[model samples]
Target: MLMLRLVIASMASSSLSFQEKYDVFLSFRGEDTRNTFASYLYAALSAKQILTFMDHELERGDEISPTLRRAIEESKISAIIFSENYASSTWCLDELVQILECKKTREHIVIPIFYGIDPSVVRKQKGSYGVSFAELEERFRDRMEKVHQWRAALTEASNLCGLDSKDFRPENKLVQKILEDISFKLPKYLSFNEQLKGHLIGIEKHIKEIESRLSISTKDVRIIGIWGMGGTGKTTLASVVFQRLSYFQFEGYYFLWNVREEYSRYGANHLRKKLLSELLNDESILRMDTPFVASPFINDKLRRKKVLIVLDDVDSSTQLEALVEGYYHFALGSRIIVTTRNAQVLKKVADDIYKLDGLNEIESLKLLNLYAFGKSSPPKNYAMLSNNVISYADGNPLALKVLGSFLHSKSTDEWESALNKLKRIPNKDILDVLRISYEGLDKGEQNLFLDIACLINQSFTRDDAEKMLDAGDSFTKIGLTVLIEKSLIECRKDNKLWMHDLLRQVGHTIVCDEHREPGKRSRLWDVKDVCHVLERNMGTAAVEGISFNMSEISKDIKMCHASFSEMYNLRFLKIYCDNIDNKKFKLYLPQG
Candidate 1:
């Protein structure tokens, strides 16, 4: 029994050490190329103890072996080494397909090693992979459909630009370069994940102000409002306060997102249920029907309890009224944090309101430099261009992130072209900054953005999208592959793709602008234009067969339509139509 226990302990230690060290999962067919270039990479990475999982294929089976699938899924990163005749074997093709799917579902980083194969050849499924696939189709003539999916996955994988296995050198310079790239990316990934943790932005000064307001003897339900342009970090600041103060006098905390939308859509019951579930830590609010029924329950639970509640993105006083109902129900020391884009809304809830200004010029430059060139200080040669990019970004965090990621890899000419485009584009509202990310995409990726904007829901899967759009031939054309590369779209565990709300708005605006009338301003929810377009086309059935196409418009043509109505026909349109009244729709199209 003691010997068995020792063996189990030894196994556990080995597993933990293996996880702690490895950074990349290298998937290669041993017969194809692993003995040479891939073997060198494995040795180099392992020497640094940057853990790599290389399946040398000592074992093979008819079905995908369980060990290979687990390694593909579990690894933090997967690099495929595709050589000539790599896709010929069913074994290699299956692994390649699984890796592509894994890219969607998991945070499995994939870097392809194109060994003696062209990227375009991979994308279009020409040359070796295509020839191999053709022969397989003949062999499995009755099972052609199953074979076709494998073809699609192979073509998609080949299309992506991976480090060429031929790019390897015995001098160790290239391997060293690859290691440097991996190291540089690791910190950036960590920083982004940290930013996504949801804290209050620009709240350090506000913390002092809050401190000044508090006194020794008694306390009141202090309402402090943090107001700024959307995405200016108002909610983030309130979150910071909530995290810090909740442990102090506050016994309860509720962090609500999109408070205005929640109240308007679900009404008071939504607020009540959210508060109850959060405080009670239950999935449901038992013994409660209406919000009023649960009010006393909330008041009773929070009576003597000092609660710190953050109501994020509260656009109106109605949301305030629905939430606290006057603040008297809480204990004396309880505090409520309200965040908004409107200063007027702030005045209603806040004993004190803060107007969040843009970051100062120096800070703005610092932020921009960090993003654009991946350095805190601009390089001597690019000082002029660096300053220009920063000046244009306007100290907005969203703008900085957009410009930084877009220009990170481009040359001086690319940066200059981007700057010229920005000049033509008018200064945008906070959400519009994300549109710059779309402009940065290649034309194919822009099409993918259009499809995602018009079609994908919060949890829509890419498999369904590929199937619905018949994306077999044009997967590369749509830029879904590039979108993943740029981190514009994230894949969830269920194989569904998700985008940030800001990114969705950017894509939506791009499509709308492109499709707008030559000289008309695009009002996103314009009822008349919507009804007119639908009626003009004689509804969904008329436009059903025609594929929607949009061309870039000139800057002088400013008043462009930028949104659409959803139709069974114009599947591209996805907007809330309920906001338009029947009278307004009639007014938009008055006729016999």
Candidate 2:
């Protein structure tokens, strides 16, 4: 157990190290396992957002190159795939030597995967290894020391605990087990670049201000609430701060994204379990699931370990109460951050409230110019246009981003048309600013955008979306790319589609304004709205889609033939009930 703790500690230490270039360096014989086992392992690691180094180029000459050796030294863990012909390669043996050398000198971990081969054969230099070494000794009889070093490396690496492909029938299971063990060693980190969209335009000041409010020098527990309207960069600031502080003195860190949505869908118990599991680096906490009910007590372990927790897009105080109980029992030096559109959610719990407003005139201009021209200031010809757009953005970071990106590389005439349309939106609300971008989309893109916004949750997988939209190949081309290009949406890891919270709200608001009556809207998602439309048989031909959960309604209403008679244009629908016993459908079909 002591050695186990030490191993885990070493993993965490290596993971957080700034100098390591990769999570795992994959060393394998290209002729044998590169296409089969090595490819599977590399793909699994990449899917988990693990930075892995795999040499794809063919092995050229006798020994490993300087670049490959450096990769082995730079990686936190070296995963060696020992296949049937692995020892036959002079290059693989040289890589193994460098990998084991790093293991002895640095805080590095070595994982050996014996693929379709016995570890005893590797450790004792028998069978295929013996044949290869006999040939190698004959070829390099003058430099026998190199052969001895190669033998020692293989023997040492084979003794380490690793996955054996034969132990698990159906090789994918072994691949999954290896992935899990690798994850167990490293701390899970959310990539800031993946979330930030790579444009650090006007967020620096917010970062510094929040850092000051955190009072990191003090020993007291701190809860900083960043309250603002949508598209004001609340999530961005929290993410930046979380990334910066995660490497510091904190015992653990967890950033919970889309808090309100998660709470509504999974309940507070889910949040509690997720937080505990993340901070403890143990998924077993999730196995301790109780009844889906609220509770004030988190684990007692949190009281002794200082941690950093960021709850993004929180809408309710109850979510916090159920997760950490307002950090009442937290350890000293722990920091909690809550980003919410509703300030009331954090009012009772936060130590200091940082109300995020719009960027100032200078910051806004710089941000717009940065996105527009790839510099802090625009070209000489576009100064007035730049100023006009930034002033119209009214300091909202989202607006600045979308507008600048939208206007990039366009002709001056196109710029005038774009700015003219933006200026025509009288009120200049952030929503109005966002609407201008939405207005630029064609009819197909617009319909798909609205469908995505009104029908889906904050995050959804591509497969589910493709089925609903019947948008196999063209869905991405017509809608997803356009929205992403305009900075209205993003495709993150795992093919999950996510849009800014404000953009979703804009889509909802637009659908609501399609008609004051719910039945006239193109899509229906809300329980009350769907019920209002269906129960009264108020369905209209205008209703193109409906996503309803019958479990959300307290009582059942008979859905009959008339329920769909009017909805001739209802091409998409998703109506589900949580309880198996609640399924009911009464259709009055025409006589066949």
After superposition, the stretches of candidate 2 with alpha carbons farther than 4 Å from their true spots are: 1-64, 68-198, 292-298, 424-592
In the range 1-592, model 2's lDDT, one tens digit per residue, is 9999999999888755536688899998888987888999899889656789999874578878888977887788888899998999998999998888887767578889989899999998899999999999999999999999999999899999998888988888898778767754553222322223325556767788998999988999888999765677888889878866664447788899988779889888878878877886778768874653323444467677789899987766787768767465668899999987655667787899887877889888877876777666788889988888876766778888888788889877888898787543322356774575567568888887888887876556766676668644566455666565445665678888876555766788788888989999898988888877777789999999988666777666656567778999987877665563544533223233
Cα displacement (angstroms), candidate 2, residue 589, comes to 59
Model 2 root mean square deviation, Cα atoms: 22.9
Clashing pairs in 2: none
Q: Which stretches of candidate 1 lie over 4 Å from their true place?
A: 1-203, 210-218, 280-287, 295-297, 426-592
Model 2: lDDT to the true structure = 0.77
What's the lDDT for all of these models?
0.61, 0.77
Query: TM-score for all predictions?
Result: 0.41, 0.45
Question: lDDT tens digits, residues 1-592, model 1?
Answer: 9999999999877654443124577766677767786888788777644668887644777557887777776666667777777767777778877888877854456777676677666667788878988888887899888688887887777666567645666536656656655554443333344333212223356555654553312577777777654445666556555544453234566788778668878787668677757755666574466444545665676676776778877766667867777467777777777876645565655777766555666766666676666556777767899788666655556666666777887888888888887654533554453454465566767766666664566556877666655435766424565565344565678888877544665655654565445113222233444444544532333221112111111111112222122233433333333344543333222222
